[model samples]
Target: QIRASVSDKDLDMYEKWNQDYGSWDIIEKKKKRVLIGAASVGIHHAIFSPSGDKVVTMFKDNEIAVWSFETFYCLYKISIDVGIEAFPSDQESIDVDITLPISQSKFQLMQQPLCFSSDGTLLVIVSIVDSSLFVWKWNEQSLHQQIDIPLFKEANGFNTPIKQAKFIGNTKLIGIVSSIGLFIIVDAETGKLVYKMPKTVLFDFVEFSKDGKFLSGVPSEDPKTIKLMNLKDFIKKKLLNYLRNFGEFPEKYRILIWRFLLRLPENRQPFQSLCDKGLHPAFEKINRKYPIKSYQMIKTLERVLSCLGHWSPLFAECDYFPSFVFPFIYAWPILQTFFASHFSSDEWAVLMDHIISEDPSFIYYLTVAYIRYHRETFLNMKTIQEFNKFHEQSIPTNVKMLLKSAKKIQTSTPTEIDIPKDIIEPFKPIPRSPSAYPLFSNYPVKIVHFQKKVRDKIRREELDFLQRKKVLHELSQLHQDIETDERKWIDYDNKVSTMMDEFWDKLIKDENDHQEKVSKINALETEQRTKLLKNIQKVRQNLVHQSDAFLNKQKDWEFKLDTARASLRETKIVGHEELQKLIDEENEILK
Candidate 1:
């Protein structure tokens, strides 16, 4: 059974979430819904009865409403106004059984409602602005008024608010822890203070054992350590009655029973206001004063969103995930205090950087595990729009779970178990000491003195051995550094040599290329010269043939001229012989 409260000026509502934990179908079918509504004022605090059949809600305006668990309806309203007259002291008959009609007129309850007792028969409320406690007996429907008990006195310098008040089991004795570190037990029936135990450190909470045999508390200064104190007759009796069956109970079962008996908070709050308002401002102060190394924190924030985005479609598309450091800073107020008190800014930054470098996902798992553990508190939230509101709310119950999961995620393996060896030997009794020859047996005092000297020498030798070990360790480290430096130098040399070889090969190739070009140029020049010479020879031969043709033509013309002349002479001779032979041929004929 879970109860959720909502309040306004006109209407105040209480919603009950009920489920049968044993039913499989109920869980599988999502058969969990908020049951509607009850009327109350602005309830500052409220709690269900031990039987879960009734709920009592306290309003800030000093109105107490009792609602029935079954029908979500208000059973009674006690408007105890502040500064109202106390219950009539002479009225003894109205202590236990109050007839509803007679005491109805005194129903002006002028205090902030606190809580109901475990049996649901008593209603404890406190004044709105003072340290006055009002206890009332719920006799059926009528609330019989009781006397007001002042938790603080005027002798004290200032008023101390009651930090926590709860009934010890089903009894009428209530245990209260004040703001000033006072743990007191009061009787709820008569509003009388029973016992007071002054504490050195102000505790956040005070709790009682189930059987009312012991009371335990967690100090506000050091909430990690829980201290238990004996109560009532149990203090005198010690553990006599409890220890009688201790041997008979199995060790495993005993731990479980002991845990059940002592019902206490697993962890204390990181700070007084971490679970409430002012957390953000305090974180802002820390951020300004001792800023964390945000490089890794930012990386982790990215990784967390990326990891969650894989599973949730909304996260995959959403731009922002929650701040990973907010929960840690809230949960580790001591760390903040230490940083502020002891560490310099640079030192703290380096420390934070180291932590982030080692494991950036540490805070991621812690925040996720905390949210997962107390997911019910976030049921009203749906989207990133509601994250601002969700971050402001506190879930103290998940602190332990968050730490456990974070540690588990960070650790690699379990520590080695220390197994003890048996003292007895397998074959014979162990010798106590090793003795030498009886050189000094005759002189007892000398032997004792010699033994002392030997012991002193042995001590000296041990000290020398330790010194040598330290020196050797330092030398080994130096040697390692030297070897590392040598390896680096060797690598550098090899790289330089390889570069030189490449440069030399390139230079050789360039030189060979220059020579090859020069040879090609010379060969081309020689070929051109040979072609020029061949062309000159061909021109000479053509000129010679033309000259010869011209000379032959001239000779032929000369010969033809001679033949014509001779022919003319022959004709002339024939004419002259026939008249002295044609003259030129006539010359030939005459010759």
Candidate 2:
């Protein structure tokens, strides 16, 4: 029989299947599964376990069921308890008409919220609505850990909905990405967030390689290109960015940051185990060697020193270990006391009398600057005794100038005087025998190492200070030159402005004179045209009178010609009889 199942166009399983006579048949006769008691109505998603022996189904009613694939029977059921309180209050006030469809689509396009580890030992689930994460031990079917996304308090309690989560290779660590681009790694067992990233625009999906060496994701801002980050490099760059952005951790966060830098685990059980071991033998001389007025402070110091001694054998051998840890306990009193095994109480008092600012933090800077001031003299001394002797002799002479320079250095910008790495890291003294340097065997090796570090730091600071001074001097000179040039440019600009004003005034006058001449020429031309038109009209009238008189004269001549013709015809008719009379008449006409 073939096993088959049917789903709607959206691939949401609505029916179960059963084998029937070499073919699969719908168990509910094409009807949707009915909700009965606590039973789930329909399967929204399903996935098979790595061993293919079991399957997990996410149902329509915020529930998941584990089923034996071969037996086809429900094994366990889990209800996803993402209550309304898990969602941000602001989300509820959002206009449904504006954001309903968009929010719905985001959920629809999101990946499956549940995943199994590579070995199938642990199962991880995330809620689409609130981004609440849950880790479960698959075999025991028990919840291991649960936490909200973006656990860092710095996230300011904002809801960053998780987009995808998966196990990193075969490790017990789970990596998750949020819609707002918060990438975090959490320990599956403890549920502690191990790594957190600053917010960025992240695409809908992110994944780790099979070996979990690299994590790759598409950025929403640059969707066409995929970014790959090496796990080690990503963490290193993140730490560097943190330090660069916030130059110094606040006072409250100092200890936590120190623990992080030192890679100290926060597990309480281990620290308690060390504390239970009692005080180290080396610190038995605490009451005699470094007398403290407060009994509680002494007890605290002993307990802490004992823990350190128990953690490392080297700490047990170092006689000056208590002094090294003293400042962290009673900060101000420790600064006032000089327990270096060399300086007398009288000499320390004399040095303190000259100093004005007794602030512990400033004194620390002052001590560093003091060591720097006496660097050359200390270097010339071949033995620790000679060094201590010089330190005593030099204190009274230059105490005032040293305090002034120390205050200046203390107030200097962080960039101008870097807080050295050696200063930030906890001091670890090298193991050395008393016979190695017999001249100063009473001096703790810790102080010698500290002096060397101070000298090195002072050398670097001196060079930096000189370079900065030179730059400032150059900048001052350049500023003066720029001022001089600006003055000359202002004068030149004023002169040019005056010249341009005169030129414009002359040009305006010339244009006015030229326009006046053109106006006069136009007026004269108009007058000439009027006179010429009048003369032409007078000539035309005389021509018309002459032509009329000539026409009348021509008409009279034609009439005279016609009468002469008629007289000639009459004379020819009576030619013979009247010949004599005509001859006389002709003679009269001729006369």
lDDT of each: 0.50, 0.59
Candidate 1 matches the true fold with a TM-score of 0.30
Model 2 C-alpha RMSD vs. true structure (Å) is 27.3
Q: Can you write out model 2's per-residue Cα lDDT over 142-175, one digit (the tens) per residue? A: 7777766545233466566677788886677788
Q: Which stretches in model 2 have alpha-carbon errors above 4 Å?
A: 1-40, 43-58, 61-161, 166-175, 178-236, 266-277, 288-297, 310-313, 327-333, 336-591
C-alpha lDDT of residue 464 in model 2: 89
lDDT of 1 by residue, 1-591 (tens): 334432222222333222211111222443322222222223345656545555565543444555554444455666544322223333312113222222222222322236667666887766525665667666554445544436454365556666677778667777777666677777787665556665454677767887575878887788898878776533223222333333222343333333333332232332122233322211222334334567565344434344333323333222222333333223232132212222333333333332332234454454455566667857867788686544444324433344556556546423342111122112221121233111212224555556556755776787799899999999999999999999999999999999999999999999999899999999999999999899999999999999999999999999999999999998887766654434556689678
Poorest 10 consecutive residues by lDDT, candidate 1? 17-26
Model 1 residue 122 CA deviation (Å) reads 1.6
Clashes of each: 29, 0
